[model samples]
Target chain A: MTLKVYADRMSQPSRAVIIFCKLNGIDFEEVRVDLSKRQHLTPEFREINPMKKLPAIVDGRFKLFESHAILIYLACVFPGVADHWYPADLFKRAKIHSVLDWHHSNLRRGAATYVFNSALAPALGMPLNPEVAAEGEKLLSASLAKIESVWLKGKGRFLLGSLQPSIADLSLVCEIMQLEVVDEKDRERILGPHQRVLKWIDDTKNATQPYFDEVHSILSKVKEKLKKLQAERGVSANESIGRTTLHSKM
Target chain B: MTLKVYADRMSQPSRAVIIFCKLNGIDFEEVRVDLSKRQHLTPEFREINPMKKLPAIVDGRFKLFESHAILIYLACVFPGVADHWYPADLFKRAKIHSVLDWHHSNLRRGAATYVFNSALAPALGMPLNPEVAAEGEKLLSASLAKIESVWLKGKGRFLLGSLQPSIADLSLVCEIMQLEVVDEKDRERILGPHQRVLKWIDDTKNATQPYFDEVHSILSKVKEKLKKLQAERGVSANESIGRTTLHSKM
Candidate 1:
């Protein structure tokens, strides 16, 4: 049976999983479970993942969730995929795992939550929560600093100083991509201090090629809709803090 | 050189790493970095883990951090350690990886944050934030529901229905142990509904044997201190929502 990936492009990790399969040339069916439509909450999707989460997969009779696991599975299961993605060397693999684990609580938290509160929530009719946005931005900036100081400080362009892009590189880069949906000023403020991070993001994109850009096109579309909503609410000019001008647009 | 472990027992993941080392008989030196004293923030500790988090390990020249990474590394690098802790099979390892990844955003977030805001903060003289505590409890409760419905539903005793405990089981069980420091009524309210989760916690503790109980003895002592703080602040009876009566007792 063909592998099936249930995902929504809007979710960062979901996009990472889809991009990975495309890059590896893994023959899989792309089943979109739209989060905006609440499609993933249905019973059928629950069969794919008992936890009812997105970016789960079904391969033959087996089922799995969590994007990191799916990526690792694809890297290991498919003979065609290269080792640099998840190297066999014991120490190297452990280092990559370190980066992946760090991404969840650090980059993923700051980027995903900040983007949701700053841009997506408003477009989706949830009132702007400046408090959460500010906190998320603090974490987002600190995460970027860690990336610059520890992971990116080495000679190699990718994380852990790996010459090739590993799953950690892809996962973290996709997480940072969520910043693209936020306002340009906000994005610059959060990411501007880390030159190494800016270059590393570019490196990850170039290594993954067409698939990385192909997957991120959805985020761009979301950005446009967010801009229109901001303008309609007069948010861009005056930057009102207390108003709940949010509407159900997306 | 013996494997050197720098950790503080009060930290859940720190204790997890230390116990795993003891249970497996991995030859290691225990160097305590007390979080209570802000020892992890010292420049010397920074050399071990740039992130300044507890439970970093050094073997000869190599250094690593992030408890999940350290656990996986210990499981793979050690020759005599059993395979069930981190199976060689790709699918099984991936499923365990799934549980570990899920633990971060779900169980770890809920247990750690809730325990800190509700109990640890006040004991350490930081004001209690009921708003954040309430949210943490909700997430913690939902996380427990997921544990029961998905991972523990199978016939096997542990998470992912594995007959033996995996690193994921060890990590998450340690996280839930933090609830031991909370108010008795609060603990029952959050965890009482899920008998499977309760049983799984006990099963994990039992499987690990004397090492589990040995490491958690520190928590029992801390629980005593936490209870005293609650009593001193009249937090046990009136349940004041906005009080900084919090003293630096720990």
Candidate 2:
């Protein structure tokens, strides 16, 4: 039986997993767990992952959740995967683990929170909380600055100066990709200063190619849906939420 | 040269790393990074770990941070360390990774947030935000319930049905142990419901022995300091901050 991956492309981690499998030419079943419809919360899905979160996998009798875990497992169990993705050397692998662990509370949190409040909230009919959005922007900038100075400091193109893109690069660049849904001005202001980060994103994209674009295409549709919603409402929802003031404060 | 661990026992991750090294008998130098005194934020420490978090390590020329990464590195690098702690088996190690990744946003977040708000806030002369504390409690309860029913479902004494405790077990159990500094009644109310969790905690302590007790002793000092502060202040700080009404609502 092929490895089974339960995911929705809308989630950053899910997209990373999907792109990873495709990039590595790994055969797997993609099981969609729609978050917007709350399909992941169903009883049947709960049996597969009691956490009831997306990006889970069932490999034979083994069950696993958490996207980073799934990525590491796939890389380890599948002999065909390149070593650079998750190096066999203990020291290099440890560095990747450090980056992934830090990503949880740092880059992932800041990027996800900012995008959710800035774009997805109104699309989901939830009011944007400007105070939280302001906080998110601050965190987002800090996270981006760290990436520019620290993670990309090495001579190579991706994180930790790797010749090939690692899971950390895939996960983080996917997070930064979410900014496409935000207002153009706000997104630029948040992401503009980090030249290295922008270049690294492009580098990661070129490395992953068709799979990267394929996994991320859902976000483009999301952007279009958000645009249509604003057009139909006869106003930019961001303006209605006083996003200018929020951006200024940030 | 011996491994050097820069840590402060007050931080949960620091304690986890300290206990891990001691439990496995890895020789190390303990370099204190006093977070309370803002030592981690200094220019010198920043050179070592730009993230400036507690529990960084210097192993020869290679420096790394993030306790989970440090734990995995130590297990992999040091010979004669038992396999059960970080199994070489691909499936079991993946499950352990799943638990550790899930831990950051769930068990660790819930436990750390609740303890900081309820106990550390007053210790640091910061007022308690009861609303946030209530939310923390809800998350804490949900996390504990998941640990009991899902992670500890197997007959083994530790997470993922392991006969021996893994780093995931150490990190999470240490997070829960922070509740000792909270109000006795509140701590019991939050932790008492999960019998398996309690048993697992005891099992982990037994497995790690004197090192677990030694590393955790700082929390006892912290409990005493809190007691002294409450007596000197002549009122419950929680009452001053309206924690009771918030608890009633919750």
Candidate 3:
């Protein structure tokens, strides 16, 4: 049985899992749950993931959620590809694990919330809270600074300082990539001053150009759909509601 | 070379590592880093863990931080131990991993912060902010409810529905155990209303009584020392300082 990944491409963690499977040459069927429609709240999806979150996986009889766990599981299950993504050296592996742990509460959550509040909410016809968005921007900036000083410090290119990309790079890229979906002005302000981070993003894209192309194609389609929907609602971008209420169901 | 763990028993993650080592029959040298003295900030400790966090391990040339990573590393390194803690079964292992991931941002950090701000701060002659403590309490309650509904739902005894405890249970118990350091009234509030969680804690302690005994003994010594120091300062328990500062060093 092929691995089945339940995900929504627009979600950051979902994209990271997709990149992981693609990079490792692992084949998996994608099952999309429309977040805008509250599809994840259905009892069936809840059975698979009680948390009602996306980026879950089902492999034969085994099912799992939590992106980092899925990433590690994919690495260990496909041992042939492990050397590239998850190093066997004890310390190196620990560093990778540390970065993944830090990502969850810090970079991934903070960036995703900011993007959702600032961009997705308006697109989805929800009420945007300026106060929340401002708070999120502050958090995103502080979190990015720490990521630079701690994880990305002294690294040659990739997060772990290796010549090749690891799961850390994949996870980090998927997180910061959400910046592209935000208003270009906010995106530039949030990510502009960090040259090393920008270079890292470029390097990640270069490393996974084909996969990045495919992923970007999907994202562009989603963005177009969002834009048309916003036009129909006749609300200006600045007047759009925050997307956080939509996420409250999960 | 003997394994060396730099930890303070007051820390939830640190306690988890120490308990894991004992439960798995792995022998290690314990180097207590006095949090009060700011010992963790010293250059010597920084060389071992740049994060300056507790519960870091040094095995041979390998040094690892992050309690979850250290727990997994120890489990993998020791052979013939309980597989239930870190299961080989793909989905079951993923479940444990997911819970650990959630624990870091949810239960562990929020709960520990609540205890520190509400109880430890006042105990150490620091002013406790009621507003901050209330916010921490709110977050803790939400997290505890989620744990009940998600991870521990319908489980028998341990976290994974197994009679034997897993590392997930150990990590969780150590975190919740920090609440014991809080004053009796606050402890009553947590243990009183959250019976299932309280029961789980009792069951865990009962299962790991020897380890609990050893840990509590060390904690009691530390408590006595702290009490003596407070008395020498002629400060009563209720007297509060303006802010609770994390000792500058550690």
Query: What level of docking quality does candidate 1 show?
Result: medium
* Chain B vs. true chain B: TM-score per candidate: 0.92, 0.92, 0.86
The 10 consecutive residues of candidate 1 chain A with the worst lDDT sum are: A241-250
Candidate 1, which segments miss by more than 4 Å at Cα? A235-250, B234-250
Write one digit per residue (lDDT tens) for candidate 1, span A135-187: 88888889899988999877888888878999999999998998898878888
Error of 3 at B133 (Å): 3.7
lDDT for each candidate structure? 0.89, 0.89, 0.78
**Each prediction's RMSD to truth:** 5.2, 5.8, 7.7
Candidate 2 clash figure, as a count: 0
TM-scores across all candidates?
A: 0.93, 0.93, 0.82
Per-residue lDDT value at A172 in model 1:
91
Candidate 3 at B15: error in angstroms? 0.8
Worst 10 residues of 3 chain B by lDDT: B237-246
List, residue by residue over A1-250, the lDDT tens digit for candidate 2: 8999999999889999989999998999999999888899999999899999988999888889999999999999987999889999999899999999999988888887888877788676786677778878888899999988898987899998887888889889988999988888998898889999999999999999999998898988999998887686666655656877887889
Question: Model 3 off-target regions past 4 Å?
Answer: A79-82, A117-139, A153-156, A216-250, B42-44, B123-127, B153-155, B183-185, B217-250
The TM-score between candidate 3 and the true structure equals 0.82
